[model samples]
Target: MSLINSLLLLFIAILISYLLVQLMQWSNLFDKWLDQISKKEDPSFGNDTEGLLEVVETLPQFTVSDISGQLIGIQELIDNKKTLLIFLNEECEFCGSNFEHFSQLINNYKGKKNIQVLFQSNQKETARNFYDVYDGKFSVHLYKKEVISEVGINFFPAYLIVDPTHSIDLITHNPIQVAHSLNFD
Candidate 1:
């Protein structure tokens, strides 16, 4: 009888623990806790800083076309100005969210900072779609994959700030990083 009572007690504890966990999950408390944990993690842990370092540390001169289908070189686009290069994917959910924040940033810094929106050369249709709806005064250009690869672009919604000397001063994975880099935060 004593052994049966001990087993019953253990079962109850386990059942209570299981239900508590389920309640937390059902209320999304577990997810919020996980999000807090993830937010505390080092940003670089998810970013391949090594990959960008291994690739071109400086912005390279590469040619891409503008909205009118006219070919333009990177040097010409930047034209000795410090530029913020934003590489966005039309299909990416994150990019769609970031676009609004970025548009506001670009509008605020219009002439003060040379901000350029880049799309993969292959994504002409997607680029055109973005261009059509985009009301920002910033120039939108298409970039070759090689150009971005040189800058160590491994993911969508990539960002880099190149100084007037063509040095890549900042490389980042998220919109917060962009805001921080631009000192808009």
Candidate 2:
């Protein structure tokens, strides 16, 4: 009888262990499903290459100040010439590393294109310092933090090409590709 009792106890323990393992497996599967759903809901979670292909037809009306405290309207700038709007952040390492490349790109397209560097940050001085360090070659603007969210930008170093008709022609993260799309060298 004692042997039978011991066997029964062992069987129950094994059953419990199996059930616990199944439960864990189910939990893991559920977590994975949840993650997929989250990514699907958030467009920013996907690959940057895919995101860059989307063309933004219209831009939100915005008026931001340049480094010299002059107010500049987005529509007004696009009205004058084909504008290259480069959105950057002061604290972004990617922006810091690519500053010279961007400056060179601006210089390469100078007079041919109105290239503006838009820095959205509450710390105006930091943005100014970043512009000054880069020799202030491009037209730099300082905007409030909300401008980034308003533009639906998930990452820094985004480029948008606005034609004289005030329509956005190309929007991407790769500045070189954008320049190429516009037939810039």
TM agreement with the true structure for every prediction = 0.66, 0.63
Candidate maximizing TM-score: 1
Taken over the whole model, the C-alpha lDDT of each candidate is: 0.70, 0.68
Distance from true location, Cα of 67 in model 1, Å? 1.4
lDDT, candidate 1, 19-63, per-residue tens: 999887656844653354356324643434553334456787788
Give me the displacement of residue 142 in model 2, in angstroms: 1.1
lDDT (10s digit) by residue, model 2, range 1-185? 99999999999999999999999987886586446434433334222344433445667788989877888788876666777888888765466655566556655554465778888747578778877876765677887787777766776667777777767666666545564555532
> How many collisions per candidate?
0, 0
Q: Which of the numbered candidates is closest to the native, going by highest lDDT?
A: 1
